[model samples]
Target chain A: MATIGIILFTLVVTLAVMLGKCQKKPLSNACASFAFNTEMNNLQGYLLPQECEGYVAGYVNSGQYHSDFAVAIEAARTYLNTIEADQDGKDLIVLDIDETALSNMPYYVDHHYGVETFNGETWNAWVNNASAPALDAMLSLYTDFRAQNWSFAFITGRSKSQYNKTAQNLYDTGYTGWKTLVLRLPDEENLTADEYKSKHRKRLEEEGYRIKSCLGDQWSDCSGESAGKRTFKLPNPMYYIY
Target chain B: MATIGIILFTLVVTLAVMLGKCQKKPLSNACASFAFNTEMNNLQGYLLPQECEGYVAGYVNSGQYHSDFAVAIEAARTYLNTIEADQDGKDLIVLDIDETALSNMPYYVDHHYGVETFNGETWNAWVNNASAPALDAMLSLYTDFRAQNWSFAFITGRSKSQYNKTAQNLYDTGYTGWKTLVLRLPDEENLTADEYKSKHRKRLEEEGYRIKSCLGDQWSDCSGESAGKRTFKLPNPMYYIY
Candidate 1:
């Protein structure tokens, strides 16, 4: 009788899962975990912006964000030390502008970390103001690379039209002496950031520079053909561009 | 002066997109396009479940879900027509039991679509009830394959212990005449659904079965080595399982 009851109970429970009530109201925990795992594996081609607000907020507030980047940079530093310096053409470090060199925390904070819609007009004024500060961790890494006499190049999604202001902003923010600042030409504006940036890196390689390291916040920064020998990614749960 | 201001404004607007605010909101339009592209490409990786809920909900609520499967099955039918009938060995079509063969719509509707925690006991009881209705679209496909003399196999994530009840449910629900129903054994329960399912597909291949098509709601149902020549997917936005 006991065994029969147990069997019956089990059957009933299974039936409930298959035929029970509407399990609406969202699985918050499961949703969060699933999104995190998917992003970690880069399984999805890209993330939905609406799915990022809370996730990004938590990431920025967490100390883990800084530590993750620090760990990646440390690993990169160790790897770079092993590579023998080039005597002829300089070994290069490809740096993505925007979130890579300058922190956009101010804009993100004001806008609720990407919860708001992106307005081109508002963003352009902010950039032209040149108030954005350098990312301390990346700044330190940049200084270290400079100490080793590596050439720095900025490959950004920014258009060539913003050349003067962007240049002035970079110089004012303490990232001096970059070998090249490759901006997207008007003809290449429609291409993806990955396509545009990869094209520039290939051009640089053709000009006899070996990219020793590539650093950025987006996967597109490190992906594509002619990507660097080493790549370091910073946390940017605030938004996904790719 | 107005013309100059307009030109300046255009430049700034372009620069803003290049250098401005965090573009964080989920682009529903973009998400739809990307998911469509990913599915068309049959990309190896999976989608983030959180990111797919709205899209999936829209798909199911709309008639698009049924139509999509109809198109896929139609394509398979055309392809299957080319295969010569074999007398000694039989061609096989693999189906995932839970969402593919049986519709768990009742449970999802009542439970709010997997928002709540998955209670194994409750789900087991539901399964024991053996009342899940057949998915009409898939049943028609199954019948069509049978008409061609093709064999059918079921590979599910359900534990081996649930074999008897699961079999009963499938039979009662009109998914009869399957060649084999493979369940996850105790030792294999720890593996991800993808890894375990891949193992079974490989084993089936080793046993000399030629898999012509595989159908399921999850990418795991159709990915990895020994995957079928053709794969068909159905929509499920409630939750994702690895």
Candidate 2:
């Protein structure tokens, strides 16, 4: 009976040790996948879904996002300082509109921070309002480059139909002296942002403009053919564009 | 005297309101710049410095880093599934070493989580130990693709002298059936990781290998000519490599 009790005790202790080992093991692929999907879903909208609204809000409110943006802009400035403006006035810097030059934070705040699926009508109305505030760091970059006699071109995903309002907004927000503001035309709406932006950039290069730097919140704005000599990506954990 | 007292009270109230407004103002460019520089300095090593050690430790300990890595690998797998492996066995997937293939966590933990500048002697000793564990997700990826008869080429920045140890470490960690393992040669030591890796990728393409996907923890691993049909970036907030 004593020998039997010793055997049983050993078995019990061994099983307990095995269970503890299992508990301490690293996360399996399934658990990791589930967590990733949850994070991605929260980041699905142009800003953030309701579940992660506080996180995004805190990122902005704590000023970390602004600091990150400043870092990117600083890197761009460092790179741009190395290139002399062409004597032919062909040196150009490309800018994207939304989340790059302008902040749609006011609209997003009103729309559940983009928890709602994008509504074309509401977005168009917001654009027509022409009240978006300048992203201050970008405005400073634009103003500094403009003072240095560098040409600027704004290539945006905003539709050409809203050209009047977009131009009005740019002017009101302290942006001026840009060589061109290229907006998505109705015929080109089917193209991806990358495709459309690349087409416009190729055209700009053909027009004898030497793109010195490209700045955008999305990779689409800074990728593809003729994407400028240097590209700077601003922080936009809100949404992704292919 | 009563009139003077009322005027003074109004001025005091106005002063308090202005002070509140000043306190609520956004971070200035100077403040943002300072914050950015601090963050960059902390990320100067191959891993984080002492100040941000807890942040990185928490990220890894919380398993969020693993989840993010799984997400990237899942994306790559999704893309790869669409491409059929070539009959001639020319289909290839490229992988980066270090944080991508092997977990250096054990070593980093011992070295202040990389607060210390990267020490070649210590790092080489660790490498020669030939005991680095496989990044489990990557091992699963290797096994899965190997079963499908797809080819893999590991292009690592590890020196050629450590080839035997690296090979033994990889094999012991369940990685097998790789078509080639390319390490940095002595003459190629001066080249940037990007330049050296790109050169090898170009050579692979020249050898008629079709690089369907590339995966790495750094942009330098996935950029440059002949990168791949698709590139997936794994999370590595610990450091930045040019």
Scanning candidate 2 chain B in windows of ten residues, the lowest lDDT window is B36-45
lDDT of each: 0.68, 0.76
Candidate 1 stretches with Cα past 4 Å from truth are A1-31, A34-38, A41-52, B1-242
Per-prediction DockQ: 0.02, 0.08
Candidate 1 lDDT by residue in tens digits, A1-242: 55545555555455444332333323333323333333332223444356566766665665445554554555556667788657663798899987778877888888877667677888887877777888777788778778777788999887788888888888888888889999889999898887888998998999999987787777678776777655665556556665
lDDT string, candidate 2, B104-206, tens digits: 8889888765567778999999999999988888888889988887999999999999999999998999988888999999999999988999999999999
Off by over 4 Å in 2: A1-50, A86-88, B1-50
> Model 2: iRMSD?
24.6
Error at B240, model 2, angstroms? 3.0
TM-scores for chain A over all candidates? 0.80, 0.80
